[model samples]
Target: MRAGLATLVLLALAGYVFLHYQTGGARAPECVVTGTGTGEPYRLQPQQAANAATIQAVASSRGLPERAVTIALATAMQESSLRNIDYGDRDSLGLFQQRPSMGWGSEEEIMDPVYAAGQFYDHLVQIPGYTTMPLTEAAQMVQRSAFPDEYAKHEPQAAMLTAALTGRAAASLYCTSAMDPAPGDPGEIRGRLAHEFGDAVRTDHSGRDITVEVPEPELSPQGWEVAHWAVAHAAEFGVERIVHRDRVWEARRSVKGWQAAREQDTADGLLITVAP
Candidate 1:
């Protein structure tokens, strides 16, 4: 009887393993976060990854340091899990949960991720020595949340996200997305780029391919910022591939993340190819 029971247990375990592999259980889409030099990575969903990227972009465009990005991200993670939502604690809405009643912005403006981020930074810089202040204290100065200490726990994850989004974690940001063949709209891409990076991003389209140029030389961080942003929004924008520096990310095999690329005339600026 004992021998028979053991055999049944073994069979059940085997069946479960087989079923797990057959269903793509462990292979589901996810976002990966790694440290700049060396540290364990953190994993989260694609939407969170997009929100992180947007927060970083808005901060960088304002010429804020990576420290500012870390604080903003930590605050958002604690407030809304990095999501731009329409609901929050009474009168609060969007990431960072800024209350419209407190003069952060109109409900419609706060809902815009870029504008919300800008508002957060605008207040953050006003705090004397916010750059050197403790993460929790700095965040509290702006939020005045009932539970101020909650922001501390999120700082490590926020730092990791800042590293990846700001290009310090080189080749570290990627999102798993469904395969879609439709081409992205060049007009929309140009507009979004302008909104984030300002009018400095020179955009021109040739057929389905959209080219964005940051004419200044040796702007690796700035270039990578744009490249990673394209990757984060690839599925939404139908980006086929992104080439910057010596690495390339292609939609067909984006699961592998950034990879070494073939030599090309990338001297003028980073190149992004959109799908048709």
Candidate 2:
């Protein structure tokens, strides 16, 4: 009887271990969706979506890959649904729900989505072997969640959001906010670009918008610099279109003939299309 009982116990233990390994030692139910089941198309709140774009732009400016962006987005989605809310578990606050009491920063600084996301990424990149691990494990390592495995469930949607926002895959990230155009200061834009890409920047003014063109040799090295600068100044200049070689990118503004094909390598250099 004792021998038979021992055999059964061993088999049970083996089965449990197998199941644990198979499920990556995390509970499967933790990742299950619990939100509304209405199959209607749902959009994120305007400010939340804008915050996602800002995070993506900041990450891209740092030259981080799409995976990092996805991880950051997923973490943010899980935390605050990409909203820069001013509350969370205990004293935790901001987009990542980081506690200001825990050396993250002051309450106001932590509430800033860009600052919070940047700090989160700064810490995330430090985890050893984080890139190779599963998304849930990596995120869990960073967040130490009570339900550690839940972060995995958001990976697919997070990947889609990152692609859409980063301009990696072709998809529009639209927001329904009222159009408020702010013409960016040309001098500031030029000074910033010159600081980043040296003095290779050429400046021109077309109506109310200022187009800053960079040289061809600097294009490869300075693409991100220019791209980030443009995105940062997007709200300003009521930026209608961003035209690079063979690609004409449009933003929210009234732009007529802004999509014209470009064959003129004008004296300035490569064309950077902006709007009034």
Candidate 3:
């Protein structure tokens, strides 16, 4: 009887171990990538990826972070796959497919990807806890979609896109423009960054077409925040190289350029060197 009882005890222990291994020892849902890509899987088409660039540009222009951009992209992906469609559940139209009767905007503006994205971000930022909440929850609050849970399905891909577009991660983003020539002129990139970071930016007469120098601020919480913001906007400036503390981060494009190293100067200032 003693030996039989001991065997039962060992069997129970094994079962527990198996269950723990299978479930990661908690009831938390496993992080699953649900689409085609190897990392941060999403179900958007090539055109949608281009639309995402427009969305990122709009968010960057508003001084919003990658998190906000991600939320907007996820919301749009669930709503219209980033396409500026002219139809919706009723009279809805455009990228958001917002109903004009609902006070969204005129049909022409709604179909404009940049305008649509900007309006979406505007509404999203006004939410009380949007910045800290889960992407799906924050998006639902703004969209108030009847199928609220559908937004959750796009989080993985949205995260991947944000990390790549914001330069937080390397080579995680790519897109094909609607026109082979690319939609917006590259000059708009610099203009938008300047608008967000401020007119304090300085230019060198060295004939380097697209570079700006930002004075390192005294080390403080605000300084760090601004420095981080500059780094985040690096992609918007067509910056492919950043030089600070004798280190360089270079990429073939602005999105790739964001991997540059961040160095803190002795004066409590953070120097953000970027490639134009």
Candidates 1 and 2 compared: the better one by TM-score is 1
* Candidate closest to the true structure, highest lDDT: 1
Lowest summed lDDT over 10 consecutive residues: which window, candidate 2?
A: 27-36
Model 3, span 69-175: residue lDDT tens: 88988888889877778888988887777877888888888887777887888788789988888887898888888988998888877877666555454333332
RMSD of each: 4.1, 18.3, 13.8
Model 1 TM-score, 2 decimals? 0.86
Q: Pick the candidate with the highest TM-score.
A: 1
User: On a 0 to 1 TM-score scale, where does candidate 2 land against the true structure?
Assistant: 0.60
Task: Estimate TM-scores for all models.
Answer: 0.86, 0.60, 0.54
Residue 163, candidate 3: Cα error in Å is: 0.5
> In lDDT terms, how accurate is model 2?
0.59
What are the runs in model 1 whose C-alpha is more than 4 Å off? 1-26, 36-38, 215-219, 264-268
Candidate 3: residue 112 Cα off by (Å)? 1.2
Over 127-152, each residue of candidate 2 has an lDDT whose tens digit, in order, gives: 88777778988887777778887788
Give the per-residue lDDT of model 1 (tens digit) for 1-276. Answer: 999999999999999988865554435666777665577777877777777788888887788999999999999999999888899889999988999999998999999999999999999999999889999999999999999899999998898888778877667787655455367777787788888767546678887667766555365566777777777777777788787777887776666778888767343567788887
